[model samples]
Target: MLPSNTLPNPAILARPRRRRSPMTLGAAFGLVLALVGGGAWLATRTPIVNLGNEQQLSDSGLLQAWKDGAVIVMIRHAERCDAAPGPCLAEPDGITVAGSQAAQRVGQGLHELGLNGADLLSSPKLRTRQTAHFILGQALASADWLGTCDPQFPAEAMAHKRPGHNLVLVTHNGCIDHFARQQHVPGGERASGYASALFVSLDGSGKARILGRLNEPDWQRVLASSGR
Candidate 1:
C-alpha cells in the first residue's frame, strides 16, 4: 500500500472542507500524487499555497528556512521542446529558447535567495539536465531517482538533502507532484507550471514540511516582497 499523506496544517487549509458532491474518474485520479518506492510505484496526499502572492511569500517562513539552510526546492523543467509548436532549443527532447531564458530568470531568483551553501541537482533526462544547466550556467549532478519519479521519491529526496546546505532539483511535474502529495497537498494546489518551483524543508526534527510554490512569472514580486 502507498504511504498516506498527512493532513496539512490549519493555516494552510484554514478554509472549511466541502462535502463531496460528485467526481469523474479522471478527476478522482488527479487527486492522487504518484510515487515509486521499493521497486514499486504508488500514489500519495494535501494542500499547497501560492507563494507567488507577495503577502503569502512574506508570511511563508521560506526565507527563514533558507537562512537556516533547511530547504529543498523542486523546480519543474522549463517548457519542453516537443510540448509546444514553437522553436526548440537544440533538440526535440530539450527545452525551447524561451524556456532557457526562463531558467536563467529562475536562477536569478535563486541567486537572490543565495547559493553559497547550496547544491544543485537534476533528473538525468535531457530536458531536466538542460534546465539545470541554464539555471546555474553549468551542468548539475544528475541522478536516476530524480528522473525516475517513483514512490521512493520522498525518501530519495530526503536522502539527497544535506544539512546546512540548501538543495535544488530540476525534475518533471509528476515527480514534483509526488512530493507535494506526500505532504498531503489539497487537490486544488496542483498546477506546477514550466520552471515552477515547490519549496520544502527538512530540519533537525527530520520532518519534511511544505513551504510554498512559486510559479515562473512570480519571481519579481516575490523578490520585492521577500526583501532577500
Candidate 2:
C-alpha cells in the first residue's frame, strides 16, 4: 500500500494568476496617439493666408476675411530679365517685359480673388512702382511708409496702417523676406515672383504673427497639407 502523501491544496491549484490587463495597455496606447495627433494638428495649423485658386480666396472667402479686419499682402517685385541685379537700361522702369507680364497675371488673379478693394502700396524704386502700376492699373504715388529699402521709411507698415484698411505692398524680394523673417514665415530665403502671397495675422494683443505663405508653385498644396 502506498503512503498517503499530502496533496497540494485544491484551492491553491485553482487560484487565478494576476495577469496584466490587455484593455489597460490598449487604453494607454490610445491616449498616446491622441496626444501626438493633437500636437501635430497644432504645429501645422497657422493663421497664414490661403493662397489657393479662385475657389479658395473668393469674394466670399479670404477677401471677405480681410474686409472684416486688416489684411496685408506683400509680394517681391515681379520677374526681371536683367542678368544682374541692377536697374533696367532700356527703360527707366526697372521691370522688364517678363516682369510686366507677371504683374498683369497678379492683377488678374487679384481681380479673380475679389481684392479690388485692396489698398495697394509700393516701394519708391522704379521696379517696385512699375509692378504696383500693373496691378493697380494706374501710376500710384510711392509711399514712404511702404519702402523697406529706404531707411527713412517706417519700421513696420503693417503696424502703422490705420483701422479698417487692407494693404497690399509691392516691394523688392529683400524687403519682403526681411519682413518674413520678422514674422517667422518660411520660404523667404528663396526669390519668388508673381502670384505669391504672404499673409500674416495680428491679434488684438498687438503682436504680428506669421500666419501662412502662399507661393505660386504650391499654393494649393500648402492649403491641403494644413488639413484645413
Reference-based TM-score of each model = 0.78, 0.59
User: What digit string (tens of lDDT, one per residue) describes model 2 on residues 1-228?
Assistant: 555567777889999998879999999999999999988866754334445543444422444446555666677676564543644534644777766766776665555545645567787877777787876688876765565544332246665554556667777666666666454444534344554666654556556555445565554343444332
Model 1 TM-score, all chains together: 0.78
Pairs in steric clash, model 2: 47-211, 48-211, 48-212
Candidate 2 has a TM-score of 0.59
- Deviation of model 1 at 222, angstroms: 1.6
Question: lDDT values of the candidates?
Answer: 0.86, 0.60
CA RMSD per model (angstroms): 18.1, 8.8
Residue 71 local lDDT, model 2: 62
